[model samples]
Target: MKRFLSLALCASMLVASASAVSAKTYKMKIHSTGNERNQSTPPLRQFAKTVEEKTNGDVKVTIHFNGVLGGDRQATEGMQLGTIECGITTTSTLGTFDPRFNVFDLPFLFKDYETAYKAMDGELGDMLEKACLDQGLRILAWGVNGFRSISNSRKPIDVPADLGGLKIRCMENQLHVSTFKALGANPTPMSFSELYTALSQGTVDGQDNPPILTFSAKFYEVQKYYSLTRHVFSVAPLVMSENFFQRLPKEYQDVVLAAGKQYEADVRAATENLEAETIAELEKTSMKVNSINDENHKLFVEATAPIYEEAEKLVGKDIVDVARSCLNN
Candidate 1:
């Protein structure tokens, strides 16, 4: 009887210890260039939630939005150095490391979000992930920020000629600069954090961003007109340090990747749903919302054609060709 009681006590103790071990906690930080409510919010928050749930509260991901860590470039470099664990930033921001990322900047590259998603979730997405891995970063997933639109105080941009002599804020990417220059605007590449003040202070006459971003940043408050240029389809990548990722246990790595996939779905749904409502809300504030017709779109497209020729040299003609093929298919 004594032997049996001792064995039972040992088994109970082992069960308790195993439960305690399984409850172990891990923490990580993720940073982004936009504020918490921006389109990237869904994915960043969902990713954190999924990681915690998948690990049974063993892993915790804390998100820092709105350039809390730094600008996109700084955050990306920090990821590369393992100073920051994760970040979701524009492909334009990552272009400095891998010029191929500028392929996202190809004007009118994606006809719609469905086509873009197919490319990103399929072969091209895989290629981008491998490219990031080769450059010492791990791209877990891709998220969309929707199509970019033009907003400015100068005038309603009905045609490319209206952009002439207007100073516009653009992401710090050569493709962006070239596109604006081709359209006759003086493109000034600035960090996101500085955009509002630049708009208010008249340092810049206008800028372009997705509706959620323009709404969240309250850019409508300073600017008077919003044009649905839908010029470039924006993509944000969720990336981690390759070195740190490689150090994690295999199971943990799988957990993170799964969390990323879940986040992607959440972000896409949230962004698409919010776009129309955001535009309506902005219009209520008395900002003129103009939808450019197909005729005017031709002018915009003609203006940006040079951007493709210039970008092909930077990211290779093959990459441009592949992306263009996605447009047809």
Candidate 2:
């Protein structure tokens, strides 16, 4: 019995030593279109720093900001094909890969940040993440671009009726296109990478995004009116190449996954602070900023409620029903 125990301990030590010797450096590249200093850099910097510290430099994450890797869809496809290791892309872009992601493009699914977090971190996020994995992309963690609001070069949107006949640049996703069309706006589908040039060149008169993104992207320079329509809560997910993730040593996998979750929280906190700061800063700029009151919000809701039913056709009826239950419950 003593000899048997001694042999088992020797085997364990040998395996541990082998594992330590086998640890190899992995270079992971994560890309996004956010501003390097303002929007995209912080969480990625935190992630890279934490991962390297935890693994003692066994893994290094290279973050490419401002679409240097590619536009949202291109970067996502790069990761899916394993040419890149990871990407942080908007939910609208995810919808192009799988229609189920259209759920996030639904108008006014969440009323506040607290409710949005509850739904995303819970069952709704699970459902969407499963769809992503099934489609051959592994979601590391869900993040956000803050609540989207309307901005126009023409006029302030105090009500839904103000959107009529306006040409707006929206994501190329069908759901967003249909949502804007339903509200009587002429929605022009365009990539976010081209948004600034398009606005500057008069290709589109208006767009919508969080205040932070509006300021960071300098949309306020081209847009004269910033209306707090707060129409849709945008979702951005940190995703990794499933093949790359599965190929990692188990220890590295744990470290990488934990870093994704940690920096998700970090980015969320940073977004909250930046949203307020950007609003104040935009007020200082030559931009007219306005907010939607309860009556206007209700009007926007009434005009767009049919989108929920239309979304059922895009993703499925059952998941949309489940989403409604989760949000209400």
Candidate 3:
């Protein structure tokens, strides 16, 4: 009877210990609009793994991709509402959350990856991040979305005039809408989740995205033209709910921030490595690919000059000047 009682006590203690460990674990949900296989999602998965390993399984992360949780805008809003723990959203979408971020959305704002990263890692990034924090988002790291290009079923876009009257799907940002409007294209703001179907059904003529997204989302299957517009170099932030982040233990919070920094490097590397390969894959499809010549590119730059003025009015001229300074420096 004594032996049996001792064994039972040990078993009960083990069960109680297991329950305690489970209770101590923190659960985080990360939302993404892209599919599981996209360039952005894999790095996010690595981030989750690193966070778990570093935290010794005290922090559990679950990634919801393919708009499973919601679109970028919805995910960011969820983070604000404290319903979502984390998510990926473009700076363009974030402009709605804090208009100061709209400066990144201006046409031809960033010339290359180097310029964009410089801007984000320096003064401009600091200012914008603080603005986001005020709006209830804690930006953990900045990742690449690649330079955006135009894809359509209508025709090849060799010049700004090529965009006239074409119904293009744009992100829900005033700058993007204003950009397409200036090009004479009718820009329709739509959710990322609804984009593929809208294209397949002929609801919109064409859309713009990084070549990586164009290939990953299979936009090539529905669209017949791919133009190397490289108009906007897009960057996305891996963001956490300020409320959720603040609730984490200090040690776990530090782990999360470090993991996010690693994620930024991983995502940037993935995007750069896949960019040429993705464009090559697109070329192998039915889509007609074209690039603008220097002269025509100048025309595009000239055509969108008014966007800077509009951007200044929206994001403040001081911030706009600061972004331009990034290019000069």
C-alpha RMSD by candidate, in order: 3.4, 4.4, 4.4
Which tens-of-lDDT digit does each residue in 1-329 have in candidate 3? Answer: 99999999999999999898656978899998877668887899999999999999888889898778977888888999999999998887888767888888888877778888888898998998899999999999998889999999989999999999999999888889999999999999997779999999999999999999889889999999999999888888899999999988898999999999999999998998899889988999999899889899888989988988888889999999998786566
> lDDT: which is higher, 2 or 3?
3
User: Which residue pairs overlap in candidate 3's backbone?
Assistant: none
The total of clashing pairs for model 3 equals: 0
Model 1: lDDT of residue 172:
80
Q: Per-residue lDDT tens digits of candidate 2, residues 1-329?
A: 99999999999999999897766678889887876656546887888898889888877778788789988889989988999998898788888888888888888788888888898888888888889888678888778778899888999998878999999999777778888988889999887779999999989999988898888889988999999988889888889998889988898889989999987898888887888888999999999999989988888888888988998999899778866764464
Better model by lDDT: candidate 1 vs candidate 2: 1
TM-score of each: 0.89, 0.90, 0.89
lDDT per residue, candidate 1, 78-190, as tens digits?
A: 98998898988778877889999889998878878899998898777777788888878988878888999999997899999999999999988888888999999999999
lDDT for 262 in candidate 3 is 96
Tell me the lDDT of model 1 at 309. 79
